[model samples]
Target chain A: MSTRWYPIYQRGNPQLRVFLPNFWMKLVRPTEEQPPNVVTFAVSTEMTKHDVKNYLEKIYKVPVVEVRTRIALGDTKRDQTYGYITKNDDVKIAYVTMPKTEAFKFPDLFEKKAEQLEKDEKSMDDSKEGFRKFLERNKKRPGTPGWFSI
Target chain B: MSSTLMKCLSLANTLRTATLRSLLTSQQKPTLAPWGAVVPALASHVQAVSGIHTSAASLGLMEFFDDPKVWSENEVKVGRAWKPDELRIKSNKELHQLWYILLKERNMLLTMEHECNDKMEVFPNPERIDKVKISMENLETVVRERNKAYHLLETGETGERPQRLVHNCFGLRYMYKSCEHVLPPFMNIKWIKSRNVGFGGRAVRKFLLQYREKLYNEKRKAKNRSRNEVMMILRRNPDFDLEVLRRQFPQVNIDKLRNEDKARGHYVPKIGV
Candidate 1:
């Protein structure tokens, strides 16, 4: 089957199998709180519930019990200065129901980001101090290369 | 008596050699055990130790997420994209597997980027998505090359979708990609009518004329602009290198422009001083 030109399916024909499917599904964090079994995904707008089911089951090896999908319209906003309106692209969101045995939670990736920033700032301050010391030491010898001293 | 003893020894040696040959053959071609299970023979052993080619799928849903180690990093360092030259050497199976790998990486990056945008946080290393996209494009190109070569060898034609240059009703030529239809061209009335459109109408001819004139005007204006620019440069700098000006604007005749009044500097010439 030609992937670029997908022909209409007719009865009594060979079942179509996509050998190299290029569909992409992004596992999105749900805006609203959902059950542990139901994992939300932002998929390609062209994908149906069946495609999402097959994608998760065959590709990710996830046992999907039920799949529900909906296209959420993006919000439109007007520019404050120009008053021109712009709208975001509508996205197909899929809620995949997994077996009760499987449990997952959206991870807090940036929980430690605050501490990381503090550490980075401390290191930056130390580097500033070191540079100031180096400049003071080189006061007597103007236009000397940094490597010539140390 | 000694000859008989030697004959017995030769028979024993042949028997031993025959048994060794049978064992070597069995090791070479692995046999299936009960219930279609492969016997862990030499060939299977080598396959088992050959190392993992694809990523392990045990990560499950976590596969959609980036590695935990780089979750909160400010900048994630990564290698450059897979060049077409690098992808060309890979086997079809390897390229197919790499395509899925890159696809998954792109999905993961997009997921992270979406989450970051939702939370109003910075997504580290956003260019990683572009890298994966480039790799995927290169992979597709390599796969297409192989497919084209195979099709040409077997069918004496590129097995790609057929397209032809056709003129539309607007008198514009474009490549029309043919699509699969149940009815033949002679039978399909709608398609026939659509394809029967000819280009030479009074309005279309006028449009074509104006379009050509517009294109010619653009070209003419560009040449005139460059000529004027060269003249201005010569006027500002009288001793400017003529060879350099000639190289800069190859289309402009530097010698001819030098003789023009516009190319002369404002300063008076010291003649016969």
Candidate 2:
């Protein structure tokens, strides 16, 4: 509670410092094609354009050429059973621009996912084959433990 | 000098309300890093700012996105929360840094959760959010404990936001947390008006009467339930210790209730000294 408390900022009084900022910003994949230097972000609703600019420039150490922000309205849907309307929380999307020379593409997070699945499948098949062989060897002595023989 | 004056003018001209938050650049500048570390100048370039030396390779602004390695994993394993005792040993600066780290982690989790929900996919290891929240809460408690100890030692006060019990319009007592105000008590017309709420009219009297009646009803029912329980206990065991019953239910008068019809057992009392 004390952490959230901020002193009133007067002209001559010392400025209030936020030691822990509760605001969050997420780097979202751009829906449309744009310059490689421009990264789109979905940020906390309370965050301002200056906060986005400073957040990248300070915490993330990313050079920010400019920042543009807008609040996107959440989608509303009617319940299937009750026909009651519900809406998602509105989000603030920030478009942060870096220098022309710097480039960032939202890396395909699931690029190696297919390869991982194949590896897991191979391991599963190996385990299955081993279990089948163990069952075949233990057919005559059903009560015997695998460790007792191997 | 002219450029700075022009910059200040442009800052003043913008009425976005959020940019005004940056006006406290002086106060927020040093907090991003430790005292001896590189101080982020208000006009400095991004390359000059190195908030954490250990995380040099960790890209900024991308912290909110999910780690690429975990994109295909069905679950993410995480450790337990930082206990209060563990946090108690950490230095204030370390705790402050931990707070930022937890804050960022929480943000990352929230972003992932939102994206997962949007995509109609389950967010993996939801407990990670709870763990981070617990750690943050514990850290804050530890900090508060230290602050209280320090304040008690130095200022003879808790050094917390002062609060006082006050009566509301419904004649209910509540603890009102006081906040810092630019104006004094006398100058705050709205606060003064709110403080002098009129709870004296017949309507307020009726409301208070009904409220008190509701509270009295709850107390009366509780008293009745305890009395009946004591009666049942006495009826079940005639030789039951009175002292034990007295200690258990102080509100119920044991001696008087012992002679009541409800306390009398179905069978005649056996002859005993």
Candidate 3:
């Protein structure tokens, strides 16, 4: 059956099952410090706690001991000069609890970023030095093209 | 002491070989390993599998994060979306599995984007999210088409929700999608009351008259704009092809417009040349 139109559930009717559920849930880094077993998630606004539980259990196979959800209001800002107001979409945040034995810590994604940036800076400096040396070499011959010597 | 050293060396060699063998076996049968471990090996099996995949154990919350290799990179290149034609040949089971895959990819992208924003870093290759979205849309469309075909063959009707053109209380006509109701039309008092609204008052008639006039004015202005454009083109290029101009602006009567005074160029016409 097409998920666009789900059959209404009446008493004594068979349970409704979603074959291709469009609901999306993203595991997000918690804004605050929490227990290791408690994970944060930003789920679709339409999804309930039960939906989040089932999604994790069935699809990702993540065992969930408990689920608590809250809809966080999106930020609203007024244009500084235009006097117009704009609002961001509100997100439903689901806090899932795993077994006490299951502990997860959000990994630092950009730990190597600083090192990479330093390496990039080093290369950039090398290029700049090379260009400076080329300019110095060509100082005597003002009209000489770069390809004339290199 | 020499015999003991030799025995220790031999025992360490056996341990190393045993670990190597286990690792090779795990890598060879990726389907038997955990979901996270199977990702690298799944590339070859993706084309061969036509049914649902019972992936090994989950990656826990770590599945939300991207691979560590790309975390520091400035760009991540990926292939394009799945086209409808490509999805059409696949069975429903494969499409369902693909949907979950796309969904996870989208979630991963979104999570990374959010995290990047939080860290004030650039989310590399943002177009990857759009690609995943396009694929999901195409997959849904293919599934809908199959559903429609099946319904038509078996039930003699498309299994789509019923909708009808309805005039609202504001006198604006719109397509109102009908939903399933527990009570019939006569039994549902609230629905009957909501749907019973009719537009008739003098105020509404005046509003509709003004609205129609506005629509007519827009149409008239568009026609005049096209006519003026054609006149300008003819004025600038007097020897312009009439057939091409006629095809370009079919609404503007090019034949009648050709002899108009406005269409005449500033230069004097070559008479009887």
Q: Considering every candidate listed, which one attains the maximal DockQ?
A: 3
Question: What are the lDDT figures for the candidates, one per model?
Answer: 0.75, 0.73, 0.78
RMSD to true structure for each model, in Å: 14.1, 14.0, 9.8
Model 2 ranges off by over 4 Å: A31-34, A74-87, A111-150, B1-57, B229-273
lDDT of 3 by residue, B1-273 (tens): 556546545543443344322533454322111122222223232122111112334565666777677788776644456779877876776677667777777787899998999899998888878878888899899999999999999999998888899999879999999888999899999999999989999999999999999999999999999999999999999899999998999999998998999999999889999
Clashing pairs in 2: none
> On residues A1-150, what C-alpha lDDT tens digit does candidate 2 reach at each position?
566667778898786677767677777778889899999889899998988897777777789999998999999999999999999999999998899999987765556667866877898899999999999999988978879786
Over B232-254, each residue of candidate 2 has an lDDT whose tens digit, in order, gives 99999988999999999999999
Model 3 residue A82 lDDT? 100
lDDT of 3 by residue, A1-150 (tens): 356788788999999898888887877889899999999999999999889999998877888999999999999999999989999999999999999998988888899999988987898899999989888999999878879985
True contacts kept of 2: 0.55
Model 1 residue runs over 4 Å out of place are A1-3, A6-8, A138-150, B1-54, B196-210, B233-250, B253-258, B264-273
Q: Which ranking of candidates, highest DockQ first?
A: 3, 1, 2
Give the C-alpha lDDT of model 2: 0.73
Candidate 3 chain B: worst 10 consecutive residues by lDDT?
B45-54
TM-score (all chains, Cα) for each model: 0.78, 0.71, 0.83
Which candidate ranks first by TM-score, i.e. highest?
3
